[model samples]
Target: MMFDAWLTFAVIAGAVYLFVTEKLPIEVVALLVLASLLALRLVSTEEALSGFSSPATITVAAMFVLSAGLQRGGSLYRLGELLAQIRRGWLLALAMMLLTALVSGFINNTAAVAVFLPLVIAATVANRQPPSKYLIALSYAGQFGGVCTLIGTSTNLLVDSLARQSGEAGFTLFEFAPMGVIFVAVGVAYMMVARRFLLPDLGIPEQSDTGHAGRYVVELLVGEKSPAIGRRGSELLPDDAGDVVMLEIFRAKQPVSSPRGEQVQAGDRLLMRGEWRDIEQARKKLRLDYDHVARDLDGDVAAERLHAEAMVAPGSHLIGHTLAEVRFGHTYRVRVQGLHRHRLAIRQPLDRVPLAVGDVLLLDAPEKSLAAMRSDPGLLVLGERVQERTKLGRALLAIGVMTGVVTVAALGWLPIVAAAIFGCIALVMLNVLKTEDAYRAIDWRVIMLLAGVLPMGIALQNSGAAAWIAGIAVDLVGGYGPVVALLTIYLLTTILTEVMSNNASAALVVPIAIATAETLGLDSKPFLVAVAFAASTSFLTPIGYQTNTMVYTAGGYRFTDFVKVGLPLNAIFLVMAGLLIPRYFPFS
Candidate 1:
């Protein structure tokens, strides 16, 4: 039986690695784990499914809906707009980093990062700075800042809930505030200092050179039989595309990626980057005559556009709609170029394929259209954009309801589960969030991931595997005493988070952290705190946190970008937490 439990543990760890590495779609990985557990009889099907209803899961879902309400209300956007006007270089970066860290302390870090990315880019551009410098800082700041509060990130919430289940007093919003604030302050100071010396001034040379706008250069040809053969360049291009500024037109000569709009002729070639697919489709439909001779002309023009990516929310209006039905071009003035169904590639024509929540869509549209599409309840824009504001009264009311629910639960007036459900209902009734929006905000991938992984945690606890692991942990640092043991838990969780999803890492490590604390007969609060902070502070790799991944592609950062900035910050936090945990909650 013990061997069986260990085998279950091995299976789960391997599965989590594969899932986080994205070798398989997260939902599929989850479903497979659930099936395997049931087949092996390690846990009953009911036990495996119970995590779906767990309080932690409910709270996470409710928080997501609450984030939507806040986003819809436009409060986040307003905050972002204020940040964009700051012009001092290092001072501006510090302000943005501090604000991001503060905001992330109270909301999902991923949402926090998404909301601030555009603001950071705009601010950098306004200050005549390269966006790449600020983007990396913003991503790391959000992840680290979330450590300041229990509601700051999902990892904190998960750890708190697990502590409660272990019969310990769970953390309050402010419980972690002291350490979090200090860490963020130190981090802000570090960034302010580093920005001056370490970062390069790679901003585009001219006002016209706005690389921060995220446009790609590409080439398009006018086929001889196309409808646009005789049309003027300005007339053939849509108003949005025309505004992008064509750099040049190549005719029986070398290629041009940017052609002057007025210079185009029937046999002319366009060298452009802004919304190329829309241009190509327009050219093909119009039957113009030319060849894609821009030496830089790349494969799949649609994929080259920066604005072409989207993720399906859990309960979006788009869930059942096909691209054709939505008249993606006619309605939104955008093209659905690629679809990721359940995180796997969907090779079929997007027009004929039905959409589902969690499916990622690659779209091609002008920048303005792309911005509008992001705020649309039917689609979750994957690219970074400025946050938008909605009805404030509604947003406040929803926040008030959540506050009340948390208050009630803390007071023992209601169970956390009941309070969460009540909060969900209150948001809907107040019209702060629509029923569909609320449902879509829930990340079923996370819910399923948690559900599938919980049983394995249980198996670890049920079998002697946890004890064996704990014993090894104890021996490795036994001479160093309980403080070392606490540090070990924190370091282990931190390391795991760099390679896996923070939530998944927490689920795997919390059980071990708890068991280790028990073996030492010490207060588990410090150990739990370590796990919470470590899981939320995954900065070394983009794969560690969703916020990191969100900024990775948008910032055009390579993998080493994360390592360069994050590794040092991770070390700083690890040391700070190790020192502080012992001081705050000493072991007997």
Candidate 2:
């Protein structure tokens, strides 16, 4: 039975690695584990599915909806605006990071990151700095700040719930505050000092003549008389387009990649990436007439659409509505040539999909629509026009609702799950987020990943895999006593986080941490803290945390970028956590 437990543990570890490395979607990996456990008779079907019903899962799902509301209400954008106004150079950046970290200590870190990313990007751009410099800092700050409060991240909640299940006193929302505050301060200081030395001086110009380069809706257009007309697009633009990158091309209203070598037609639109001058020069040199008829191409001519990009505004009656519902072409007199959300291409049909906050809507509409959009109170026309209005009332309302939920949960007036759900409902009722758009805001991928990986955590404990691992842990650190054992657990959990989802890492390590505490006959709080802190501090690899991935492409950073900065930060936190955790919850 013990050997079987060891074997099961090995399987779980392998599955976790495969999932973290994205070899398979996390849900598929989780399902695979469920199937294997049942096949081995380690758990019944009911047991395998138990994780789906856990309060942690429900709370996380509800939180996603609540986050969606905050985003839709423009609360995040407002916050970004404030952060952008800070005038002090690196000091201001440090202050923003500290505030971000402090806020993340109470909310979901990923949600926190999502809320702040756009703002951070805007702030960096405003300061004439490379976004790559500050974006990673914000991500790291959020992860570190989450370690400060149990409610800050799903990983902390998982550890707390698992500890309760193991007959230990679960942590309170603020229980980790003391050590967390210290760690946050230290981490922020380190970032402030390192910003000058470690970060590359991209010397980003103060004003990008590209003028809000993000909103350009530039596409490719192949001419009938061109040398490359009938040839496959792939042949015309090899996988690599050399200097000029083709974003997309339209043939008969259908998008075809240059990689596919699809033959180009007379009126095919080609979406290309180049500076304004370069694009203009290319147009002249190629002798290709511009498709001024394309709404996206010709829209906002007054502002000179340097790069073809578009923007979406809140409260435009477009919120909570899909492109299909808007009859985009007929009603808005615009056709969505392409969509970019979070810097990724959206290949799906625009009509069937609902828009989320931060989504960049690419429209082939008359240039006048840009001015009209700018006039709408709920809309913001990026690049061409900057319209600022006081949405303070709406922003405050969102903050109040979110605060109420946290207060209610803390006072035990309602369960955390109920509180979060109610908060989401209130936001929708207040029109902060439309009821129809609520579901679209929730990231189903993350929810599914959490639900699927949870059962594996349960299987580890039920099958005695946790105990088997704990026993090995005990012997390995036996000479050093409980303190050493605790350190080992923290180190192991930290390593796991670098290779897997933080939530998944927490779930996997909590059981073993508790089991080890039991074996040592010491208080479990220290071990639990170790697991929670370790799980949230996955800075070593971009794959370890979603925020890291969010900045990866945007920053043009390689994997080593994370390693170069994050590895040292990882070690710093590990030492700080190891020393502080035991002091708060001594191993007597």
Candidate 3:
């Protein structure tokens, strides 16, 4: 191998490591890949920058807006409301899966799940069932539906774009439908049987009679006689108490840099967190003075301070930063009392707890603050819009535009990019969505990720590295026949997708899949299909898919829950791909 090839491999290994550890955000990792290649002069600047202009990138941004339009205009929410009428548990689960899968085939999977999530939880609680029984199924169904169409996921379009760049006629809108439908059929049925045996009843979350459902973040003033003065912050709350944590100590009105290690002062203002009842107990036991926020809650029988549950919205800026870093209480004027992450309920020291999508926060927010939080676009305060009459005209228009977008692209009236872009324009012009809402609807992180990672594929091809790796793969498995090659590629893509970004896995593997096909003197379509399908089927863990992450906290599922349920499903997919992909698109 040439030095450049070796260098590219090194870059690839570094990228894979960073992506798996998530030591940095995905877009940051992607830009690093681009910068490494540029600094090494691996590809021309044009080729490196080409991803920003890629059809896949533009189409994906447009799809985000379109999906947001559907959600905003109430096309999805109105449909979701009907599930509330379901009388049986099995029927409710089945309907949630079917509807989410069907909707996901056209829109972004994350958006589909986000719209239906509260509804799923509500219906389950109403029926006295654990949300655990149905939430993972909802996440999986979104994946099932995503594979059914070209526009369903950015990954599908990305693979198509990569294939087109490789000099092949790319896939059409429904080219993926036959296989996707098969995945949906196998998945929905498998979850139906497996959930009963494999999923545990995590139970419904409890709410406080005070209307605050979680822990409280409050500021306490140190009294002259308080024993807490001169005590270290860590000692403020004993480990066994599990009730209160001193997040920060304001010494003489200025925050000490390290709250825990810093000793408290006589006049320090301490920011503490725990359940309301527990916090009250601590304040009394410690002889502390309560701040006005506390007194407001203490004396207000009128309930002017509203308790609402807010979820970190998908694509929210709050994903990685801790609450203290965001100055959450000060910025939003809400006191967070409780937080649920994955399957664990965090009760104290919330300043260090970073937020992620689907993390539900129990908040004691002023009525005015609740309005600001609702309109912030980064938080989904449940029950805020439950009764807003669905916009009949705008809903129909949004539905019509989305349908037209899918139909035109399917009919070859325009490329998927043109159709999606025009559809976004139509929605804004028709007032189904506001212009600013249309722009806000797009997850720019994904756009930047696509723009940055697409060039890594270019680097692989241009550096002769993809061919070098493809030769090695062909040498190891080529003699075993093309079926073996197909399975090998599928497994490799699946494993990578489980740990890293799906689109990144596709961007990296598609070039190799194409290279392997050319080396073996076979058609690459089936290989590309294997990449597309494998990349989309990320069922092995909570963090692999955004929808999975959302449901992780909402469902109260442990890591092994996904493994217990998704393991058999993954095997079924491997078998399905091995048996069916060849039949659908043969190696000639």
| Whole-model lDDT values for every prediction | 0.68, 0.67, 0.83
What does candidate 2 score on TM? 0.78
RMSD versus native structure for model 1 = 8.9
**What are the clashing pairs of model 3?**
214-337, 214-338, 215-337, 215-338, 216-337
List, residue by residue over 208-302, the lDDT tens digit for candidate 1: 33233233334455565656555555566655443343445567655444343454555665554343345455445555423323323233455
Cα RMSD (Å) per model? Answer: 8.9, 5.9, 3.8
Tell me each candidate's TM-score.
0.76, 0.78, 0.88
Local distance difference test, candidate 1: 0.68
- Model 2, position 296: C-alpha lDDT score: 48
Give the top-scoring candidate (TM-score).
Answer: 3
- At residue 543, candidate 3 shows an lDDT of 82
Better of 1 and 2 by TM-score: 2
lDDT of 1 at 163: 69
